[model samples]
Target: RHGMRLDAADQAWHLSTPTPYDPPLTYGGWNQCRALGMRIASLLDAREQESNAGSGHSDNGTKRKKKKHKVVIHTSPFLRCLQTSVAISAGMAQFEAPKDRTSSSRPRTPSQMHSASPKLPLGSQKRYRKTKLRVDAFLGEWLNPQYFDHITPPPPSSMMVATAKAELLQTEEVDTFTPTTTQRTSGGSLWNGANNRAGSSRESPLDDWSHVTNALLHAPIARRDRSNSASSVGSNESSGRKSPFRPKSPFRHGHGFQPLTSTMPKVEASTYYPPQPHYAISNSDTIPRGYISHARVNTVNVDYHWDSSRHLQEWGDGGQFGEEWSSMHRRFRRGLNGVMEWYSQHGSEERGEDALGLEQVMTHESTDDDDQEDLVVIMVTHGAGCNALIGALTNQPVLMDVGMASLTMAVRKE
Candidate 1:
């Protein structure tokens, strides 16, 4: 779980450290993730069969070589997501490779496997070891200042990898409680009565993150100086009565979306007035929700309900608060595009690995075969990032209410 700081008066709203699952995931949650993994595995198996069928033997009786399919999984830097990805990976391992491929010596049914836990079958482990899992920092939860009551930084990369490994270890043997040994002994339990309940109920013990490298660090807190605040530019008392130019509205879409330009100045929220108790103001003229008033209206606060300092920190000194929206869109779009490009390039000719360090193996395409190469890319991210991904894939800016552990699938059109 992540936390946020929403104190508007506090300019440098800091992001807290990520917290592990309090009670830990229920059995049902584990089952759902495992099912998703199984589904993905099944889909890949079917695709392999299609490829094999389409590729007829050469002039000799020898079988034609099939393209090597690589499965790349990208996950958010969050602890919970990393845990879920491990479960899904284990579930995928449960699938037996095709019999004709000489990968599986014997077939094992559901009853023969340990479906109750996230453990991979002994044989299946070796079969899918090459499946790559990488943490993509951009895939972390959305950094919308207005939406969060408390903002938490992502887990360090090493810690995240360790958590995933720990989750995987849990499936090695059956246990009533899924939390690690450290988690079990660290804190008090929910039931504090006659039974003298054990195990941690709130926070899990912190891991030794000293050696953790590649920590996914977010924007640093901005300065608290009010002189540098956007409001100062408007308050020019030398000869001015009032600056006619107002700051642009921060909303990305709908009633008050005033686009930002090079000439426009940034705006900071001065005060926030909570909604009034009374609904009607008898004879008084009231502005409708989401509507902006035009008559010398200094009431428009671009940083309304938003921690503009966070955005400023992310974008640097001269950047506007709303700039984060476009930046995020570009980040996600590039990531998705890179994944597709990697897939397309690796399917045919071999090339040197990219900056991401993903190993690209060469594969020969059958001249007579007309079928396209298959690629499986799994992205485990937070709800907001998921929405951003959807927006990027569809080339439309959208905001969707996404919940925990929700799954979204997108297919690129040929």
Candidate 2:
């Protein structure tokens, strides 16, 4: 207390206090402790008042603090730093010492200010040069992944790709075989995509591919001639060929259709015309071996047959067949294929002088059959209603004697 330099005014103010002052300490410790306690209490308070004579009066305590500036603080910034550090250390000690904050709550002082606080990411200390420098270095690798990581391209979506055009065109052909117009199978040429392959027709690509090799080598004319000669040779050798599968010839009208060998051969009863080089309805068949041919040509197989009564009612004595029927039958005959006719003789007047049959085989034509069989004879004589059987043993007609002399023969050699 004695060490503190108080002015005369301060001494008078202290003497005027209502509280009785204790006697000074043996070593003056009591007065010094009281003075220190009063100083600390004054700093904790928001305002200081001088009782006998107060000189300052300012709002919000700013003027009061200025007037109480009797505190000759060691005011250097270094001293301020030191004071903050000391106060913070003392508070930390109190905190670590388990002082109940709720009971004797006290304000703490802040210390150790850096340039700035750390930003968001881990290890990003604002004071650490490496982290700050790395943050500043980051460019736009965030926005574009392609620039960051390499990527292989993917297949285009359907909407993104345009389709290719059809490679083949369906060109028509003249069925030189049938003397009629024909067409080539383009096999859905409009869409030739690899993904569009379907069942059965998937083989079309394989077949077409085989043709491509030959197509690359041969010119049109050379290919055409080759195809013709190959076809003339046979069908098996020309399987992979690209040339036309058909050829033109008015004299040839049939295709690969052969007479049904598995069934019985019917005897045709019409005005039949044996095939001629000039008026061939169709081409001769390429018959396979072991197949016995049985054909009925120029004769239509119908459920209802023309009876003699109907025939007589139409044109009594004109002709056995009507004119219109004759014309239609002729047209059908002309357009018929593989037409065959068998002959029977009963006085050669055939059924009433007008009944007709197939023309005879040309004498100059060469025949394939080597051996001739026994002639089978059948005749409707002027007699009772009955049919007779002929035996190969004696070349004799059984039951009735209307004999074998009138029958003609056509058969294969053994």
Candidate 3:
């Protein structure tokens, strides 16, 4: 039943099989198959050991010739046959994955050439282009051989490195400028008047909001009329200031909606209490959905400062915009009155957690185990075929690290 036969003339066992032979791989059959392989290995090992021992002892003048008898030896011609077969299919060595030719019923789109869905390419994934581009995709920068042939000396008069390019870069830097501003302030009544009109109910903040805004609109005109009439009546009531702050906002958001910007008055830097300073955010951060931040107005100058020690204990952290700029950098620049100010001020302890919660979200998501390690060998007959197949596998990222070739090399060396 096994695929092996003896060739008496050649004095070896040769592997013989039915033309369309198929080996068993069921639970019981796999064990039998392994046992057959183990038997062949043992026979080969015994022969090699005997050959080495015989050579060492044969140096004596009285060497004994091996006994010739009518021995029914189970010489393995199968090993020689398999070695020939292996040499023929050497480059075709590969792990055969079961193919499912059936197609899925799901609709296909042009964006997806196959069933694989493309990742959203969201959040920290954007940074991979900047951080891992050299190691990942070469883009215009792969160091291949075609360009290496053109090494040349530059023209003698050229000051290439230090003088020419350096001055041009510096000139571009100093030439740019921004307009300066003078600081101004609105009366306190403008903000205080709006703040008093807090929404009465989550469903109905508009009614209460209307009362506060009405008083604000009338307050400005009332003074103008009073001042002109005061000129007629000869009194100093108009000389006094209207309320510095006002109740202004009817901040209302519900059913997954944010408060409208119209509720909050926009202040220009020149007209604000103190001029707002521009904070440079070198890192771009993505905001998690539904992160609420209480905007605690800082007493410091109008420039935003996200003070970690001072404000974050009270208000929640800033939304996507307020995350750590550089986790690698030990220092954090908190904006006291800016975007960072709003995020760290929220009180909820379990706040800002989101969909992308795992470390894999920030790292390379997959590792190919075969590409990371090697395989085990079954027989000495696998030597030549294993090398050719291994060369093919090594060239492909998908097929690499199959150490079967190394096993074949070790067998040949032995």
Best by TM-score: 1
User: How do these models rank on TM-score, best leading?
Assistant: 1, 2, 3
Ranked by TM-score, the better of candidates 2 and 3 is: 2
Alpha-carbon local distance difference test for all models: 0.45, 0.22, 0.25
Off by over 4 Å in 2: 1-295, 298-373, 380-383, 387-414
Residue 312 shift from truth in candidate 1, angstroms: 27
- lDDT (10s digit) by residue, model 2, range 1-414: 011112121334335433212111111121222233234324322233332135345465533322221110110011111122122112211221123478336543455234434444443212100000000000000112232132222111111111100000112232222333343444543223344323322222323343543464464533344346544434534565444433442112322223323233444321222122233322122111111001111111111111111232121111111224233232222211101122122321122323343221211223224212122221111111111112222244334433211221223234
Best by lDDT: 1
The C-alpha TM-scores of every prediction are 0.42, 0.14, 0.13
Task: Supply candidate 2's per-residue lDDT for 301.
Answer: 14
**Per-residue C-alpha lDDT of model 3 across residues 22-54, encoded as one tens digit per residue:** 111121222222234334334443544455455
Ranking by lDDT: 1, 3, 2
Q: For model 2, what is the error of residue 359's alpha carbon versus the real structure, in angstroms, after optimal superposition?
A: 4.1
